[model samples]
Target: MTPNPPAVPRARLPLRAADLRGLSRLGVDAVVGVTDVVEAMHHTIASVPGIVGPAPAGRPSGITGFVYRTVRATTRTVGRGLDALWAAVPFDTTASTPEREAFVAALNGVWGDHLADTGNPLAITVSLRVGGRPYREALATPTGRLLVLVHGLAMNDLQWTRRGHDHGQALARDLGFSPVYLHYNSGRHVSQNGRAFAELLDELVAGWPVPVEELVILGHSLGGLVARSACHLGAARPWMKALSRLVFLGTPHHGAPLERGGRLVDAALGLSPYAAPLARLGKARSAGITDLRFGNLQDADWQHRDRHSQTRDDRAPTPLPAGVATYLVAATKAGRPIGLHGATAGDGLVPLASALGEHRSPALALKVPASHRLVVASANHWDLLDRPEVYRKLRSWLR
Candidate 1:
């Protein structure tokens, strides 16, 4: 009798293996970036006639050129060999874990453009997920009421279920609304992602198996900015008619203090010629990170200017959509005796005023009525995701 076929070794997940390759590429790029910085410093110093003279105008000897070429060719060959080896290995897509997926999403949020342009395996494509499956397959029948949950920077849809609970799942079970999680590369420009998201929603609505009755969006942190951006761009789309409510959780409507501080660091580094090259390190953060400096949601906000420049907040005001119920949730670390200072201090990353859309300029301020705003005391930022009290407030509003 023929013995059972030898058991096959389970292959690693494609993305997990690809992450290794992506990291290798990042190492190569880091080496190249350092070399470029050093070369630039050399050029800057040599150009100063008083301090240093330019080298004689002569090409390197044929032997030196050959050596350089050989080194470059060897490097390229090794890189290619590694890539080929990774490609040859089989991968089980089912092995993709939530932790690995979240880590990759964060990397994409930081260096997504590079990954997309180079067709790297680390780039995440935006899609709607239902029951942990792609929308197309999972959403066979539409439950009129739809709730879309968008995650913050360096996060993925899987991250929504935090500490044994997810607002989306609870809302669906409690309110009979269908919950959909958005997966996207958080590293891309907010406006760019916004536009794509608007288009994607338009298609989603049009393709629904059943009529869509009401649509609600719950966005956290930077996700709120993206949601607002999409609404601005898709104001005239048919799907807008179905949009009923928008809820922002710990979102920075004006800007985040962390990114603004990064800008200050970049400017300080630029003050010294010797240290200017180091500024590139700060500026190397993804466009998504830079856009947070002023909560930029439109292309005009960043179009032609130096993104790293210490410029005034010139982002065009994007007011909340009319006819839609807008809600703001701001969290603070301090409890009961929460004074103005504690409120302004916010949940550590976002200030209370910013989260509440309190801009000095009326034109830029989001007109969310006092009744629609909720402040969670003694809660940090991430707590907004799974706190029982927070869920109670959401249920009250959405119900």
Candidate 2:
């Protein structure tokens, strides 16, 4: 009888030793966070009976405090042990799989600020790349025309390739433009990423293999906000001189309602003493996520204020960069216009008016020319990345 064929091993995610260490640390943090919440709840409930004025604030006293403290201490000790064990394991410095890159990007988007603050290995450092590798190695035939593609929140450079179609690659092939991708931690504040990006671009232009004739930026969703921030901060830098065009696809220029809704939920949870402790969970979201509430692109916009507090749109007016051909692309789920509904109809996450840079306050409007705007009907947010019509428009404008 013929021997049975060897079973194929199930494919696993390409997790590294460093990932294990980072995840262990995050696990410890989670446990400590849960203990703090539980202790706060316990203290609040215990002090509720026959109390005057406001509920007692801060951690519980005596035995309760000791128990909570012990839990945290034990968790940290275990985390340190795990870190040492993982660090001892020899890790192969091979290229990361696309799945692993996506996972890291998403993790960075959710808790990137905390990860950076804690020096976690999972936190992605900002870089410019080509074909999942550093840009310098892939630019053997660098061209004068350059296209820089920046991805949206919770995304990495590899994500630009959708359904076998990448806008950057297509532009490179058709327009003789060399495409470079910007990969960054989307969980950090937009202003922070923007400043870093500006510095990177300054270095890139200064050290370009060829004289950069044109520098075009194609930004998607939150990527557009970062690009705008970079443009503003890098106005006096050398890279700005070569920047000729900027295109935004499905960008929330004003603000996204979802983030604002999240803030409202935070406010609602903060109203009751019993539920106040739970507010910490909402507030735990990264600084980058909070910046989306009003599309904050400058440090002054968020420096002193409590990000969780519900406030008016007090963002400083930032007009589009001057002397550059700027294009705005907005998408809507609805196939056609529908009167008053058209004002708010968007690509599920961003409103039409916001994407079009139409704000109630005149000072905040982007002021893009009418010819520079395009609206794609019956398209969702992600469709802006690869729809044939969108590609056609991009080619026509860039050409």
Q: Each model's TM-score, in the order given?
A: 0.87, 0.95
lDDT of 2 by residue, 1-399 (tens): 999999999755788889988898888888999888899889999888333234467788899889889999998998899899989989859778998899989999889999999999889999999988999987768999989999999999999999999999999899988999999999999999999999999988888899999999999999999999999889899999999999999999988999999999987877777887898898889888888888898888888899879488899887788899999999888877344565577899988888989888999988888789898888888999999988999999999
Pairs with steric clashes in candidate 1:
109-187
TM-score, predicted candidate 1 vs. hidden true structure: 0.87
What residue runs in model 2 are displaced by over 4 Å at the alpha carbon? 1-12, 49-55
Residue 85 miss distance in model 2 (angstroms): 1.3
Error of 1 at 180 (Å): 0.4
Candidate 1's residue-wise lDDT over 196-248, tens digit each?
88988898888877789999999999999999999999999998999999999
